[model samples]
Target chain A: MTLEVADLQVHYRTLKGDVRALDGVSFSLADGEIVGLAGESGCGKTTLGKSLIRLDGRMRHVGGTAVLDGDELPIGDDKAMNARRWKEVSIIPQYSMSALNPTRKIGKMIAELLRARGKSYREFKDELVRRLELVGLTEKVLDNYPIELSGGMKQRVVMVLSTLLDPSLLIADEVTSALDVTNQRAVAETLVRFRDMGFVKSMIVVTHDLSLVYQIADTIMVMYAGRIVEKAPAETIIKSPKHPYTRALIGALPEVGLEYGDERLQSIPGKPPHLLNPPTGCRFRARCPLASEECEAEPPTVTVEAGHEVSCWKAN
Target chain B: MGRYFRRKLLIYGLTFVIAVSINFAVPRLMPGDPVARMLTRNSVANVESSEAMRGYFNELFGLDVPLWQQYFNYWGALFRGDLGVSVFAFPSPVATVVADALPYTLALLLPSILLSWFVGNALGAMAARNKLLDNGALPIGYVLTAVPYMWLAILLAWVGGIILGWFPVAGGYSFALTPAFTWTFIVDLVHHWFLPFLSLFVVALGGWAIGMRNLVIYELESDYSNYLQALGAPNRLVRRYAFRNAVLPQITGLALQLGVVVGGALVTEVVFAYPGLGSLLLNAISSQDFFLLQGILLFIVIGVLVFNFLADVVYVLVDPRTRLGLEGGQS
Candidate 1:
């Protein structure tokens, strides 16, 4: 395993109290593994990704242990985590268009960035240009300011910049959400190619779009509120979901061949529970159609098959 | 481009017409007469009577014509650079008085504006990066910004000049040296200008710091900032990227403030006893020097319009989103 996270519990501080954004989530990714973390908004998918890289002011890492390449990551301490950030674990954030500096030209900005990491631009200039070309951007773009590039071009530039150091694990949070359909496909394909080229050993693609994740993810982990409800191979999770929450979520999606007249899609009944003082036992019990009295107690994660896990009382 | 120029030209023309009309009308409508006040205060025994003062006013102001006609005549005179003679000052053209006062105001205001902006923005950026530093800096800025300009001027004079004895107490230049290009003279001039400069600097620095700090704080919370952070570009890179993009709105705001700065320097100048345009305007107002006041007001109106135009151009340059109607440009 290249990345292992155990009992991760992250929360957001508010005036009222703490909001349990990510509660007791555990998962692992092997070398070259691409895991798709899918959930609705406020389901802690983005929180999980941010916890691995850099947590902002409000986010508090309550309890978690993340092991990357035989070394424990001290994610709670900002100064201690700096040594591992760009070189070991990098992230491609959602809003990549505004990521570049407006005043500096693209080449100069990249050179400054590389120099800060104690690397010489002269040594990496040729490779950088070649990589830009691979992303379908011309070398001339290096001389132009960020204002000159289109949205898609800027997104690509950000992508290339993130993977420049070939980190062990890359956490991509909704990277394709802002792009057009054509650009989305291209950017997604570029991510796969980057993995194939050994630019990143493993990746966790966080998105609300399950179909897009289905296309790229080797494994799919469905989360509800803050807990991982289901985890399996991409095919098994899509074809036969054991958890009721995952089934309802997957059923809500609009498939290409499925007509609305033939079979109308149904969205999940209620919204995710508020993390601030959340309900005891199962967080999804309020909306789960299959909830039993046994679900009043916290459901333990069960492994019914090799390498597949589900958290529900009835998952036999 | 032609359309934009035409629109701007139309605005400029309208502004000039309105300003000139106000300049001509307000003095006529004012309660006191410049000629009467001048004669009453300084006239000899022969010029004591109201009839004699009326004759002086009529001859000096060309008051035989109708008010509108006199206004038109004044407008024509303005076009020809003949802002009529100041009634109080002996036979000097109003424009000459303004011209003499203009350079000093510009010299003091321009450098003060630039230095405040530079120092405030640099500190604001640094404060945005370091949270603990921001906690200390933000309140200090608020306190400084809250201080009135007059009070700040007095405080600077006392603390900077009296207690510390680091700078001179008053005046634009040292009387000990000639106003020529010599190192000793330049240093002395700078030393003299320091108090007035510091006064304006302290007053303006707070607004810039608070504005930039708030702007950076808001920017730091934006998704764009998160994107930069996630890229592993380091703290400085993230700050520069976020601040560069976020500071666009504030730039236009700062430009608008420049117009206010030119007009609002009165209190600072009075407290410092500095002979800038603000002090000159104050003197003209107290003496009811209508023609000089009109000239100064017209000059200020034109200066404000020019600065606003420059700000618009700068807005277009800093944010491409403005050109594309994505961010800075208003609907």
Candidate 2:
């Protein structure tokens, strides 16, 4: 395994109470595996992705151990984690529009950042140019400011910069959400190319657009209310989903091959539970179509097949 | 770039014409006669003598012409580089009087504005992340910025001049020393310069520090800064970028505040009784010297316009965003 997150719990501190964004979540990524973390908005997918690289100001690492390649990550201690960041693990953040400083030239800013991390920009210049080309960007972009580039160009520049050091794991948060349809497919394909070219050993592509992730992801993990509802091979989860939440989530997607003469898109009926002082037992029970009285007690994550796991009493 | 500068120059020229016209109209609108005040000061009680003197002075000062003709002549004479003679100090040309006083105001203005900006920005940047400095320096900056120039000048004069007797309370230099490029004259100039400069400097320092503190904090929380921090760029690197971006707004603020600084300098010079443009302005008003007042106001208008232009240039140099705009490129 390249990455293992065991019982990871990250909560957001708020005036009302602690928002249990990620409550006792356990998952692991295999070497060279690409896991698509799919969920509805505010379902802890973003919090989970951010936890692997960096926890923002409001997030509190309640308890967990993230072991990457036999070494434990110091996720809680921001100061100590600096040593692991960029060199071992890196991330492409959500706001790529304003990622680079507006006043700085792209090349100068990258050189400064590299110099701070005790790396020589002169040595990496060739590789940086090569990777920029890989992302369909020209060498002239280095001389330009972020504002000088088009939105798509800026996104590609940020994408290249994030994985320049070839970190073991790259957590891309909504990397393609800001793009149009054509650019979206292009950026998505670029991500798979980067992984195949060994720029990253493994990856976690976090997105709400399930179809986009399904194209590049080896496995899919569906999260509902900060806990994993289903984990299986990408095709298996889409075709033979056991959990009702995952089944409904896949059902809502408009598959291109399906014939639907008069059928409207389906949406999950109820809203996800409020994370602040959340109800006990299964978080998705209230929203689950097959919810039972047994769901009042916490359900075990049971293996339904060789590699498929579902956290529900009915699945057993 | 040249086109951009040409457009700026055209705008500045329009401003100059309007400002000069306003300066000409203001003093003439006052309810007083320059010749009457000039002749009365000589105490010429004989009617014939007073009338002869008033006529001679009126012609010499161009007041004998109609308002339209005088306005045209003012522009014509300005093109010829003649600012008229001072009625307050009759024999000296307006140019010479202004020249003599210009150095003192510049001395007070330059060091105070630039130094306060530098020190305040540094202090504010330090206070942004430091708990102790933020708590201590923030309130002091607020109070300092709130105090007006006149009140602060008087307070400084009382405390630093009268109470301690550390320096002379009034005048630009000691009575015994004349204007010369010597150590004694320079020392006396600095000694008398301290109070007015300090008053202007302290008052302006607070606003800059507070503005910079808030700007730096906002920049530190901005997406770029957060991205840098997330990439594990050290705090030092992250803050350097934040400061660079934060200072861009402060440069624009400096341009907007330049006129206020000039206004504050006038008040500060009045409190110290310094023989600068401010005191000269007061004397011109009392003596009804419209020519002298117009000349001084003209100088002030030019100073503010030039400084604002320089700020525009400096902003372009420091901020690439503006530079791209000037280059006719979209950002």
Candidate 3:
């Protein structure tokens, strides 16, 4: 295992109260595995990705232990986490288009960033150039400002920058959402290529587009209301999901060539429960079609097959 | 870059022409004639001598000609760098009087504008990082920015001059000594200059500090800053980037502030009775000295346009986005 997260709980400090964005979530990633974390908006997938790298100003790490390659991460303490970041763990954030400094040339900015982290920019310059080319960008891009590049070009630059240090784990948070279908496919392919080239030891690709992630992810984890509802091999999760929420989620995706004719695609009936002051039982109980008295109490996570884990009471 | 400058030069040239025309028309439209005012000030007792003087004065000042001819004559003299004679200070050319006072205003305006900008931006950037300084500086910045220039000048003059008697309240220098290059004269000049400069500096400082504080905070919260921090770049690196980006807008802000601050400097000078362009402007207006007023107004218009142009040039040099726009139209 490259990453083992146990009982992670992260909350957002809001004006009203603490919103439990990630409550009692536990999962692990194998060496060289790409786990796609899928969910609707506000379903703690992004929170999980951010938790492993950097918690924003509003997020508070209430309780958790995430050990990456036998070392416990200092997720709650920003200062302590600094030494490990960019080298041990890195992230290609969601805002890649505006990620690089607008005023600085891309090459100069990268050099400065590397120097600040006590790494020699000259030593990395050749590799940086190589990686830029790997992403189909010319080394001339280094001399240009961020505004000079197209959106997809900026995205690729950010990807190469994040993984340049060869981190043990890389989190790509909504990296493909901003691109068109063609660029999205290119970006997705680039991500898999990065993994195959050993640029990142393990990865968590946080996104909502299930069909896209299914193509690249080794395993898939579905989250609803701050908790992971199912974790299994990407193929198993898509074709034979045991959790009712996961089944409903997969059913909601419209297939490429399948025509609806007269009937519309199915959607989950009710919204996910509000995370602030969430109920005592299963988070998806109110939204699940197979809710029963057993769900009123917290459901126990069960592993029916070797790699499949489900947290629903109806999962047999 | 060439096209951008050509466009800017054309705009400034058009503005100058319109401003000069307005300057020519303004005093003529006023109630009293400058030649008549000069006659009354002289108070010649003999009617024949007074009539003779009036004809001579009107002809000398070009007031005896047709309006169109006078307008053409005004343009003709203006091109030759002749500002005609001042009715308020008779026989003295308007250029000579303006030259005499230009140094004083420049000394007061330049240091105040520059020092305030530097110190205010530094203070605002520092305050954005510290809560204690922010709490105190924010309200003080608000109050100082809201103060009128003359009001603050009067306050400073009253407190520092009348009550404390630490500095002189009026004039560019003491009446006890003539203008000289000696240390004593320079010291006395600075003593009288302190209050007006302080008033202008303080009022302008507040606006810059407030603008910069908000700008630095915004930059810190921007996506680039967040990306840096997430990548574990130190606070120093992040702040350096934020400050550089934040200062770009403030450069443009400095250009915009020049005209307004010039107006404030004039008012502050008048309040302290400092022998700068402000007091000269007052005398010219009250005495209806058309040539003097027109010359001063033209100087002010040219000054504003030149500073704005310099700001555009500096902005292009500092911001790559604008530079790219200049080279390739748009990205």
**What DockQ does each listed candidate score?**
0.31, 0.79, 0.76
Candidate 2, A76: how far from true, in Å?
A: 1.0
Candidates' chain B TM-scores in the order shown: 0.89, 0.94, 0.95
Candidates 2 and 3 compared by TM-score, better number: 3
What ordering of candidates by lDDT runs from best to worst?
Answer: 3, 2, 1
User: lDDT (CA) for every model shown?
Assistant: 0.82, 0.89, 0.91
Off by over 4 Å in 2: A257-263, B256-264
Q: Model 2 lDDT vs. the true structure?
A: 0.89
lDDT of 2 by residue, A174-194 (tens): 998888989989988998999
Candidate 2 docking class: medium
Top model number, DockQ: 2
- Which candidate achieves the best lDDT against the true structure? 3
Per-residue C-alpha lDDT of model 2 across residues B1-331, encoded as one tens digit per residue: 7888889989998999999999999989999988888787899999999989989998999999999999999999999989998989986999898888877877887788888889999999999899899999889999988866677789899999999999788999999888899999999999999888888789988898998999999999999888888889999999999998888888877776664443336677788888787778788888888888998889888877887888888888898888888887875
> Which residue pairs collide in model 2, if any?
none
Which lDDT tens digits does candidate 1 get at residues A145-251? 77778889988888888888889999889999999999989988898988999889999999988888888999999988898989999888899889998899889
Tens digits of per-residue lDDT for model 1, B1-331 = 4456577778988988998899888878878877767667765457346677677777776776898799989989988999887765647888888887777787788888878987888778778778887899778888888977778788888988899999877776766666688988878867877789888887778788888887888887776567556555577767777788667877776677676555537776777666678988888888888888888888888878878888877886776544545332332
lDDT of 1: 0.82
Please give the range of 10 consecutive residues that has the lowest summed lDDT in model 1 chain B. B322-331
